[model samples]
Target: MSKNKAKKEATEKEYRKPLIKRRKPNRSIAGDIALYLFLTLVAFVMAFPIIYAVSSALKPLDELFKFPPTIFAQHPTTDNFSDLFITMGKSWVTFSRYLFNTVFITAVGTAGHLIIASMGAFVLAKYEFPGAQGFFKVVTVAMMFTGYATAIPNYIILNKLGWIDTYWAIIIPAFASPMGFFLMKQFMEGLPTSLIEAAKIDGANEWKVFSGIVMPNVKPAWMTLIIFSVQALWNNKASTYIYSEERKTLVYALQQIQAGGIARTGQGAAVLVVVMIVPIIIFVFSESQILETMASSGLKD
Candidate 1:
């Protein structure tokens, strides 16, 4: 019996030996170190501009163009920001108004795009109506056309509607986003039909099914759409809300700083840093929770 037990142990050890030998314990550690090194390098590369901007913004005016280019401010101060807000006076008030205008338009535009695009995509993906394919083809074609090509027509339409120099000129044109519809439609096609069918059998109407069943299942896609839409509109410089000085976006505001005079170079840097960093920080923090959920949820259907 003791001999049999010893033989069994030897057999088990023999079986386990191959797995142990095949396992490269240090390989995983090496891979992890390599990945971290690459990411650190990428982080530094991406962060350098932001770091430089912040340093420039904080540096004293005399040190702004000091030779050799300091990575850190020699003497940090908020004088640039203060001058931007206080010395500019009336221009500062206009800037604040434009900032608020941009925020409102972007938020509303993003929400509207998500709702309208999702609904349109749902119909296109699920229902087989007359000319459905043709309609989708038209949407695809529209997406292929650059916004610049339609800028003249859009300007004409806005002018015809007397929307020039108003918030509507900015917010209204953004409502019908072809790319957004296409993205939603593609995402919707991946969802299981059985979910919609089950909801229908349970006496849920199309609206109820779409809002409850469809939206919940595609949270990741929706979040992605929201992020993209926000970024696009927030950074937009074209159209310029009818080119009015008072009704410009943050981008236009920064442009004004340069147009006013290149002498305000440090102030321009401060404004640019503030405008760019604020949206990026907001987007990162807001989307982080959604991204965590998306990661844990896995890509399974």
Candidate 2:
């Protein structure tokens, strides 16, 4: 009877347990607060220029020229945008033409860069050739030299090719970006070799392997490359090769507006907002996607 009672007691104890337990966070509350504060501060510092532009875009002339410059506007107005369009209408060249040029250059340059960079990176990462190692090493070293360093040489080459003041001047030279190639090569390295081998076993040629198999896999990397290329080409002055007023990019036109004097501060601020919007939109939407893809790309079999 005592043993029977003991078994009953044990059964009751086993059935009386909770389904889940909550553990305390690994970090102390104070530490968590400090970390959040630091991150917030860093974000504010980085976003200062954008915040200033947005605020100034809404501010009146008197507030914009306030002795103690403020980030927040007191009175908001859309006069700057209105005045900007009016001035643009007076110009012989259409404002739409400037917008079209920027969009066209950015699109063509980005697409060509993606294709060329991906192909080059694929070869550098996967294919073994006599001088492939040396070539990739040279590319890596070349990235250390900024684009301005080669501006004079590029001007000479473009002049000789009869591409001066032409769309080709901007589009042609953009295909050879070493940074894009390097980024793609690194991302491609993380891909599984078995997939490529399996594609080959199925009678897929080099082009098929690169396009059908490889391109689909490293999407995040290329999407990231899109972000970089868009930002670069969107802001490009094309000042060196492009001499015609109508051929100038929206960025150059914005600079011209900003130089018109202190009276156009609000309009210049409006210009800044317009120039920054596209890249910001691209980044905000794709950043989470990039992180998720990078996580999955690390899985190997």
Candidate 3:
């Protein structure tokens, strides 16, 4: 009867315990407050430029050149944006055409770069082959040179291939960009080889292993690569190669307005906002994916 009573008491104690235990913070409340204050200051500093740009875009011509440029507009107006649209309406090439060209190029180029780079990175990271190390070394060296350094060579090759006036000149080069491939390869190296081998042991083919297993595991890396690729392609003017007015990007159109001297100063500020907004939006939306760690931890035994 005593043993039975003891068992009943133990059961009652277990039921009384909380299901979830909360961890105690290592830092005191004062420390946490100080840390948050410092972070807020850093964030404000970084966001200052973007805030200033928006303010400038809203400022009228007179306020824009005021002594000691202000971070916020005194009397904000949409005149700059309205004037920008009016000026764009005067261009021979329709604004929609420029928008379409940019969207198409950016979308196609980013997609192509992601797929091709991911595949190449998969091969380099997972498989061993003759000259693999040497090939990766070449890619690492290639990344050191800026696009300006390779501009002439790219033009010459495109000219030979009769792609000078065509979209292929830009899109093709983007597919072969070294940055995405390098990033993906580095990220993929951290993925567990055992997970891949397990997939293979289940009779999965190479493509299945790559598309199903490897790609999903390296989500953060590719999302970052997308941001880089989009930023590069979105800002590209293609002036050196693409001569046709109809083939020009939205950036080229805005740049033309920006060069209209002091008369178009307000419009020029608006142009800066328009050009930068798209990439900023893309980055904001994908930031979570970029920061997320690989999902391999849960899959482990």
Candidate 4:
């Protein structure tokens, strides 16, 4: 009798349920289309500058320098790039040398910044130490100021230490970014304390826990730090500290080319396009990781 009753209820439940999932309403479909259109418009607006740079770089001299300039190229050619190489060949410093300097500075600075900032974050976010609160507060306060604020004093100290005109002036100062440290600290705050405790119970030291647990977990934060460090170091002209053509960054060299009259404009646009590539690549990968981390975090609004 109980089996019959259960079978009857199951039959009724199956009868009430649909075999297929319901399709979304026309209103929902319309909303999705509108959202995608809006996003597409926004993306185009943000990308216009880079697009224009590449277009202008490929345009013939006549088209690139037209009155009330155009956004699209008329006669696309590689003359601008050829001319740029020719100009570089005539200059005292080779173009590749400038490229190498910028690459070295950016790579070293970004790596150093990630290590220093993440370590600082671990200490401040996880550990209990005297003056830790005050130290973090100082870091927070320092974030209110940009790198420009310290340029004068930084130059003075570097001059005293003879790091002036050396890569140390850029690399060492970059390692002490307050904003990166603070950003990492905030990201680390979301991490679980239990993991660290468990690691300690397993007889792991601070370094082991930091390397094995904290760094792996905070991949998004450090990736974001990489973007910040690269942008800063990549754009660094530092004309004040760096005087020689040998030490000057690629962007600075490009800036000089861009400052020339209409004749150099095509190559200038080429330079701009090249300079923008690395940052865009960094941003694309880091953005995906950051989004993934945020989704998995399961934080409530």
- Quote each prediction's TM-score: 0.77, 0.84, 0.80, 0.82
- Lowest summed lDDT over 10 consecutive residues: which window, candidate 4? 292-301
List candidate 4 stretches off by more than 4 Å: 1-43, 66-70, 291-301
Candidate 2's TM-score: 0.84
Give the whole-model CA lDDT for all candidates, comma-separated: 0.79, 0.85, 0.87, 0.85
Q: Which candidate gets the maximum TM-score versus the true structure?
A: 2
Window of ten residues with lowest summed lDDT in model 1: 292-301
Question: How do the residues 101-167 of candidate 3 rate in per-residue lDDT, one tens digit apiece?
Answer: 8888998999999999999989998899998988988888898899899888888999999999888
Compared with the true structure, the alpha-carbon lDDT of candidate 2 equals 0.85
Answer with 1 or 3, whichever has the higher lDDT.
3
List, residue by residue over 1-301, the lDDT tens digit for candidate 1: 9999999999999999988967865568679899999999999999999899899999888888789889999899999998887544666446677677678778988898889889988999898999988888888889778888988888888889999888788777777888777777877787899999999999999999999999888776677677767777887764544566566776767767757666787898788786777567756766864464344332222
* CA shift of 67, model 1, Å: 1.3
In candidate 2, the residue pairs with backbone N, CA or C atoms under 3 Å apart (3 or more residues apart, or in different chains) clash, namely none
Q: State which candidate has the highest lDDT.
A: 3
Steric clash pairs (candidate 1): none
Model 4, 1-301: lDDT tens per residue?
9999999999987875643223433447679899999999999999898789889989999998688988889788999888988888788999999988899999999999999889888999898899998898787778778777988898899999999888888998999888778778878888999999999999999999999999999888877788888988998887787888998899999888888877798899888877887888888878976564444433222
lDDT of 2 by residue, 202-297 (tens): 999999999999999988888777888899999998888899998889898888999988877888998989899999899888997557445533
Q: Predictions ranked by TM-score, top down?
A: 2, 4, 3, 1
